[model samples]
Target: MEKLNWIAVDWGTSHLRVWLMDDQSKVLQHLASDRGMSSLKPEEYEATLIEMVGDALPDQGSIPVICCGMAGSRQGWAEAPYGKAPCTPPSIDAATRVSTKVSRISVFILPGIKQLPAADVMRGEETQIAGFLAENSDFDGVICLPGTHCKWVHISAGEVVSFRTFMTGELFALICGSSVLRHSVDDEGWDAEAFDAAVSDAISRPAAIAGNLFSIRAESLLSGLSAAAARSRISGLLIGIELAAARPYWLGQDVVIVGESGIASAYEVGLIQQGAMARRVTAENMTLNGLRAAHAKMVEIAQ
Candidate 1:
């Protein structure tokens, strides 16, 4: 049996994921829960972690735990704080130590990155950026992290130089599920032709997005546009607007999209439509690789 030497955690606003890892960074077992930062009090974090992984924890010595994401937010277990940008992701020295009632557990939450002057902060994606840099040390370009709030980051010299956030995903959910468009969009299907056309239309005339949005409903009523197509257009239009605004980041630059959702694919397509070459990597794998990088650095510090 493989010995569990440590724990890797990614606790976000909506979910918590834990990985039991060996000394060599091989994952032994994994678990996830819906009890995220928004669901727990600061004092309840230790108990919640124990409830999820107590059976797998070693009986003798304390196992080191390295975590990233919203768990480091001010309202989380302990504020790991934010390290400034144009800098590497924070390591062991920047981690926040959490005192556990259980004797065999030692937890450290990694600090995230903050961009001054513009006032933008990222919690979990910085670790993934660290992981990407760990492998592609020579990479210098843009990385788009697609989620509730998509981030477009600039990387140079193994550091995050600058970044911007767009509320495309949240807006999609709001407009599709709760707005007037909700009556027209089924939000459960895809139409590649409709998607591409919408991307081209939005990119060419981004300022006309308001009228285009109403067209989704008008067309549905007047010409019987399908709900699935309406959903696709809505997604494409928002992402298209973001691309118009983020042209400086992705235009003529190597682009990598980090995420594991359909929305990520949509971003890829939107970029390709603008003649930009873009590739995607799964967020789960990137997060695990990032935790591995942090663990290696922390262990090195201990030595």
Candidate 2:
């Protein structure tokens, strides 16, 4: 068996994923940990990383590590600078590295890209963009990455022109779990029709979203709308507002939604309502794939 050459890690705010890859770029083992950046102290990063990948590391004192996500943020172990937006794959590939305590390991921390005009910044999506580039080298269009802060990235000629971040998932969590709507909505299950209606209403009158959100409780209290449906309505309003903002960028371009099933569904519904043809792509291992791609590119450039 070939020896391991590098370790690819996607250490985000809430989860840590480590992959052991052989010289041929095949993953030998994949490990996950809940010790994400949000939960660990700055000093604990090294120990956590070592604990996750120490067993599979080689003794040559030369394993190149590549990582993305919040692990490179201001609160992360080491800060990775942000690359300005309107960047290409090569620009992203040219991201700088952050050093670690491990003498045998060299860590390359990818920089997040920001669009100054829009005040939008992303720490990890750049790596996923690299992964998308790796898979569809010739494609140029809009890619929607749905998550806690869903991002809509615009790519053309291999460059990320601009992107927007929507606080859809975070807002949903806050409203459903902590806000007044929590009492009206079910924690599980979705009402497709109500959700669709809310999306439509929000899209038609985007400015009214704020007022509409407050009305969720009122409708549930006075009009007898089910809590589940109200929850779905709030989700639609937030997602619809996002879609309304993102409509201009995706107006005539092909759209691809990357992320889990539920969020992808919401994005698809919103896009379809706005007359865009959006396709969903499961990004189950995109972080690992992205880290591997970054590592390989670094090795190529170094040679």
Candidate 3:
């Protein structure tokens, strides 16, 4: 326990990921919980950290805990003010230090990046971007992060040039689970052919989206479209529309899709279908790596 150098945390909306680390940046232990920022009160954050990592803390001394994500949001444990765009990822020195009741630990949360005029903001994804840039420092292109609100970020010279967000994922859930399309859609099965065709169709005729979504229900009722086709079509159409709007950001450029296999693959596949050079990379350990990068600077600054 005395060998513990510092701690790393990726605190997001729906989950909390912690890593116990030594000076070498190697993880000695890992822990997680569904107790995300959304579920925690500001006052409870200090106790929550102790409760989660008490077993692993060193017996006597205080340890630095570097964190990234919603935990630094205005409503989170501490409000880590956002750094404007056209800048590198937030560094450890810029982290917001949260005052704690426990002397055995200190918490520092990273700030996210915000773009002006567009009024766009990101929290947890910044960590992943930092991790990506750590390995591919010279990368200059677009990074597509797919989730409830998908984000398309432009990177150049190690800076977040600009970004835009889409609501395709959330829209998919709402239309398929709570809207009129519910009766026509199934969450399980997928039709690859239907999905591919829909992506192409939507990319070519984006304005058709308003009419196409409702067509899923009509097709299911009249033409007897299978539930699998309906579900896949909806997904393809929504993602396709996003690709259409984001075409200017991609087109002949190379794009890196950073996320889990499922959603990341969808973006890669969709972009490829549109003739864009797209590839998928798993998000495992990227957050931790990003935190490690920040912690490195933190250690140096402290010294």
Candidate 4:
């Protein structure tokens, strides 16, 4: 086994992932479980972490553990506080130490970013943004993170100028499950042409969205719309509305989609159709890169 130098963690709502890292920033071992922020109490964090990553640590000296995501939320192990926008990705001096009883480990959770006056906040994504910046020091424009709650972040001069979150993913889940549109969609399928058309329609006729949404079910029952087309349409419509709202961020600007999932591909397609330059990156790469960057910073004053 490779010698472990430190630990990198991404503890989200439903999963806890820990990567034992060597000095070269390479993962020595990855340990994951379902004990996420939502399932554990505040005090159980340290013990749980040790139970998962303890064997990777040295026999004597303590090692640093750099973490990001919901583990720093209010209900998490410890609140790391949100660093407002117009500032760099909260990884520089934003890490909060978790009081650990284990003498062999020290835990630090990175702070998130908040946009004032608009009531928006992000915990884990900021680290990913930081990692992107680390790779593209001069990149400016939009970075779209597609997930349960999608985030469109505007980056300039290595800072999060502003951002907006859309409920596209969650809404799609609900709509596909039991919404009036459920009868129109299937569990899994896609129609690239239909999707692109729906997206185009949504962007071109933003106001027609409310009425257009109902047309899915109506068309399914009347004109016999295929389940695959229905699924794609639903996805397209929601993502289309998101594009319309986030037009200011991506219009004539380079976009970086930091996820390799199907939704990420859909976002890339939708943006390309809108004449935007969008690129792709794996979620694991960005998250781990962000954690690696955070660990470098944490080493500055790591106790």
List the global CA lDDT of all models: 0.91, 0.82, 0.88, 0.89
How accurate locally is residue 2 in candidate 1, as Cα lDDT from 0 to 100? 90
| Greater-lDDT candidate between 1 and 4 | 1
Which parts of model 2 have CA positions greater than 4 angstroms off? 1-3, 89-93, 222-224
Question: Which 10 successive residues of model 4 have the least lDDT summed?
Answer: 294-303
Question: What is the TM-score of each predicted model, taking all chains together?
Answer: 0.96, 0.91, 0.94, 0.92
By lDDT, highest first, what's the ranking? Answer: 1, 4, 3, 2
Those runs of model 1 whose alpha carbons end farther than 4 Å from true positions after fitting are none
In model 3, the worst 10-residue window by lDDT is 280-289
For model 4, the superposed segments whose C-alpha errors exceed 4 Å read 300-303
State each candidate's clash count.
0, 2, 0, 0
**Candidate 3 residues 18-129, lDDT tens each?**
8899889898888989999889999988888899898888789899999898999999999999999988888787889889989999889999999998999998788889
* Superposition error at 225 for model 1 (Å): 1.4
- The C-alpha RMSD in Å for every predicted model, in order, reads 1.4, 2.1, 1.7, 2.0
Residue lDDT tens for model 2, 245-278: 8888779989988888988888898889788998
Q: Which lDDT tens digits does candidate 4 get at residues 1-303?
A: 888888999998888989999988898888899999989999999989988987777899888888899999999999999999888998747689887888888788999999988879998899899888889999888899999889999999999999999988889898889788887888877899999999999988888977888998999999999999999988898899999999998998888999757989999999999888899988878989999998887666656
* Candidate 1 Cα deviation (angstroms), residue 283: 1.1
Top candidate on TM-score is 1
Q: Quick one: best lDDT, which candidate?
A: 1
